[model samples]
Target: FVNRNAFGHFGLSQDDFERGMNGFDMIAPEDRPRAIENSIRVMRGEKLGLNEYLALKRDGSTFPVIMHSTAKYLDGKPVGIRGIVIDITETKKLEAQLRQAHKMEAVGTLAGGIAHDFNNLLQAVQGYAELLLLKGREGDVGYRELQEISRAAKRGGELTRQLLMFSRKMESTLQPVDLNRVVEELRMLLERTIPKMIEIELRLTGNLHAVSADISQIEQVLMNLAVNARDAMPDGGKLTIETRNAIADEEVRRSQPELTPGNYVALAVADTGQGMDKTTLEHVFDPFFTTKEVGKGTGLGLAMVYGIVKNHRGYITCVSKPGEGTRFEIYLPAIAGTQATPPVDARETELRGGSETVLLVDDDDSVRALGAELLQMFGYSVISANDGESALQVYGETRGGIDLVILDLIMPGIGGTQCLERLLEMDPRVRVVVASGYSIGGQIERVAEIGARAFIHKPYDVDEMLMTVRGVLDQE
Candidate 1:
């Protein structure tokens, strides 16, 4: 189409003939090498290969150009290259973020499992200690000593429970949580727990909104903050609890990748005690890192709080300065509607057990023994089993007369859940109660979906267990 001696030619818009700046002359200095490499590859009658270079526009500005082409052969001689290209910078960024999120999820799952096992052991220690104190009687001088032992064990168990909750390994049933109702109910408990010298105040702003989160864990957050505030005020000061509504904007959302722009109910705890410096504040959420004295803290408190807030898909921020004060503000997504939840009836809590046969299954001898003793004390005949197979055997021996089965989720062979499946196969009419220390295999979800007879968590009180069992049986 053009003379062989011509130095350059344009395929379209040859208006540069007189006003003259050739296409190559306008190429960016930084992109010239990439363009030449592409030219060489195309001249060899092959694909231009993937490459990105800056193209100089007529306005003397540069823009990214991703040119794709393979050599076009004219009668066995390479002529030019041609292909399609599009910018992909945005797509690459999204892929990187997704990889990071997946990596975090893998680590969280591992932490969840470790915390679960630890909670089970804690349950055993706390449960047995409580049973021991109850067995001790009045006029016995050692009863007081035993009570102190149980109290210590209970405290240890509570710490384990907090860790498990932080790791999201504890059984949690998230209902339509009422923020106002919860705060009002916990006011008295909070007051009693904090030091008498510290003044406590509550402020409610904006209409409170419902949020979907573990109720007990929310209480845990409140309690942890209150205790921390009390400790901060060694010389005594004022502590404020406030609630309101929040709207996250783009700037805030960009700062917190896990948080997005949305409507949220904000809860805040602020103290007038000595505050934290920049260095201490930065490590506030790190586990096992604390400035407090060795005997005074576990350092898991803030870490646990962090995990819970993240698990709930909420956002948290802190503001502090040395000798001033510290404030923790949490914003949880608001749930829809103000549906009134039915109040827990006192009738369901009424204890009951008389002459009904129950098959109890647990690998731990102490737990099985204590369960049976507690059930028997309420006039129930409890046949104990060490595992799933044994439980099935015991039930079969009783000729399908098992009115209830107290099944443990974690066991050696033929565990509680599997054993229950087998027992139900033997007799579908069998009524059973499932219990677990650590949350297992979507246990809470299954309970809500499957109309479970009842569930009693480990480290439970005798009255609580009896009440749940009685309530379940009453439905039948």
Candidate 2:
């Protein structure tokens, strides 16, 4: 009650206090009237104890504060009011963050369920279409129609993967990646795609430490961020992408709860554009949350980026204010001693048929039959099993002849990983390719750790199946 530190804590100086700064001056403009009424009640000895208000600071910042006020009297004469104010800025921030997290988690659960079912149906559609393409003659009417169907199914598969990514269910291959190289490649692509009004500037720092991450996912993050920056600048603005090495110690980790103490590669995207207010920035990464007009955005760009970064064991932070533009900083853990692995070109490898025996196991009857038929068409003999238990029995019977196993990840009895472990125990040299329609982030890694030779996602074509089979078999 006697100290002047309360006002000083709100950024007010001694000069302002001497110049007749009052409690009303400390209240935000929109909240001043309510605060004045409450103060009047307290002065009247009504015992108005605690109230929440937006408090204004000398630096023009507003924060939530809990104000406790009571009238001080000397012998029945009211002299003044003694009050206490406690800032609730951190409390409000945590509440907002918890709400946003719960919202995103709910959205992700729904999206993942939908995408998982859709991928299964899409795989069936794509598989039958590919089989039809093999039988149909080139340039025939039916052949062209089947090609269109295959293309559309492929597009649908891509959409499902994107949804899975946003849901944090998609698997990624994390490898040492050079962010500078990724940025350079995206620069060329953005140059051709971005609007003429927006200028793309690359401030890539050389010799940046390599971060372990999925190359394609990182590319997606950069592209999505760049696209977002482009959209923020409706009239015209400069978009700059900068990279640097950063280290997060105890203090930094405390501030960014998502991060731990480690060396990190910092990738920042800054834009001089319309910018965002505090309210808008809070929900930027929420699934399907967007500011763009209808038909302009799907609102999954930043959400996908958020999922990818979190899946890669990284942290992302956004900073913005109205009329001041926006910046997003992504920090990925950096490895100590490894050269960045160059991204592999996705060009189609030659599809060659092989004369070998394969065991195909899947709980889905349609998938199993399709896989078997495709393997046979590829000039290979295939043994089929309807479930993991049957698969083990069949492998036991055909162990001497079977060269590879195409094991479905999800099965009725004895799941993929369990069946894989049993198979490895039975035959330590067993060459198996794990296949699935829906996989969590680390399913492929689990298969690899169990000695699986390769993995193919469901809905594979004849060529893709044959190529994968041959690659796995040829590996010495």
Candidate 3:
């Protein structure tokens, strides 16, 4: 034993050190028994010497360590024990990293199959939208129906994008977000959505945790869950939504390796309707596994939710039984932060008005006529071209007086992207807006970077067309 001065340096009293209890209290709760037993074994002259255990701190937090001890003797009688303790926290961390990597690799393999099929569906949707709008006459009832089809096709296109995101093939902006406000903001729309026969209730808790998730993705998951619940209870029932703080402890880590033993937020949606048996519950999360017959359900509802949650580094659980109800729970990591603010709402999203002569390019004549008519209705002078080469011919002949240029990205010969390059060469100051069916790989999202003021998706409404045209013209 040493003086009190020596004991003070180690944060222990002289008596604590002498009684062999100084390190005993430092052993973590779960490892303390084994550590103590190993000490007794060494003292009794057992052949074993070294043992691995966890040491705790003043804050009650635990870290792994390998404690090695040897018996000290004076005159053939044991007097004291000298031991060396090496910290192993970093080693445990590396082990966890290896396990997580393997988990992601397995998920990627499964997601690849889903993405391939989804792409084929998207191509059909894009191609059909191009055809339907082509067959419709302006201001006719048939044209309005075609416009609806076009809108649906675009949403289907977005679904495939989400699938790519789930496969980790698409890019995302990761940031800290507060989930509580997101649910709060969407409350109005949800209330209006559910039928009068169904009861809606919200149980939102305060001091709730924030998670690092994409806001749009989280919204999509919630929307999907709501829609699934709505479909489950076609006869009308109670739908409950809840948000709360949770901790993924040792028990949880066993089943969900994606979760860490820390704070989290649980977003759950429950419905009181005809629930599924064990057999149905097992396949509930699988794609196209809906119990709803015929054209009622696509079966991709839960699958989409599953994909989105996995992509966010989270897990989802489902509880149900025959003649009862079902509850779906999602857990996302809680990182303390505020929600990202929404962008300004645009009045219109398609190209329309301009008194200045405009150069319009599209391989399809139907999209061209409708696009031209929409612009003309907004009081803008419209000049049209059937393909990329014709667009350049018209632009060069007009001597750069074109107020705006709207280019369709997909074409028979020189593609929209290549056409953009040729058009920019003809008039460097040209105000352009890229229009696509999402088949052009972010043709709309990257319009500004390509020297265009904006991007517009096809099947444009007259007002939306007018608004986009006004906004771009105003910018010029």
Residue pairs of candidate 3 with colliding backbone atoms? none
Residue lDDT tens for model 1, 1-476 = 22322222112234554467544544578887767777787787655467776656545666555666677678988766554444444445445546644654555466566655655665556666666666768667777776776677667666666666555566665667777677777889988998889998889774667888777788888888888899899988999999987777776665555667787888999999899998898667666678899888988888778767876878778889998999999889987676535335345445567788888888877778878887887789988889889888888889757788888877889666667677777887777788875674466567444444778877656677888788766674
Instruction: Evaluate model 3: give its lDDT.
Output: 0.70
- Which ranges of candidate 3 are over 4 A from the true structure? 1-177, 188-201, 205-220, 230-238, 244-266, 278-289, 293-319, 331-339, 342-352, 383-399, 410-428, 439-444
TM per prediction = 0.69, 0.85, 0.54
Could you tell which candidate, 1 or 2, scores higher by TM-score?
Answer: 2
Q: How many residue pairs of model 1 clash at the backbone?
A: 0
Off by over 4 Å in 1: 1-136, 184-201, 236-238, 340-353, 393-399, 412-422, 440-442
TM-score ranking, high to low: 2, 1, 3
lDDT per residue for candidate 3 within 67-144, as digits (tens), equals 788778799977666677777776776575566456645665566546545544554555455455655678966777
Report model 2's TM-score to 2 decimal places.
Answer: 0.85
TM-score of 3: 0.54
Candidate closer to the true structure by TM-score (higher is better), 1 or 3: 1
Q: Using TM-score as the measure, which candidate wins?
A: 2
- Per candidate, the number of residue pairs that clash is 0, 0, 0
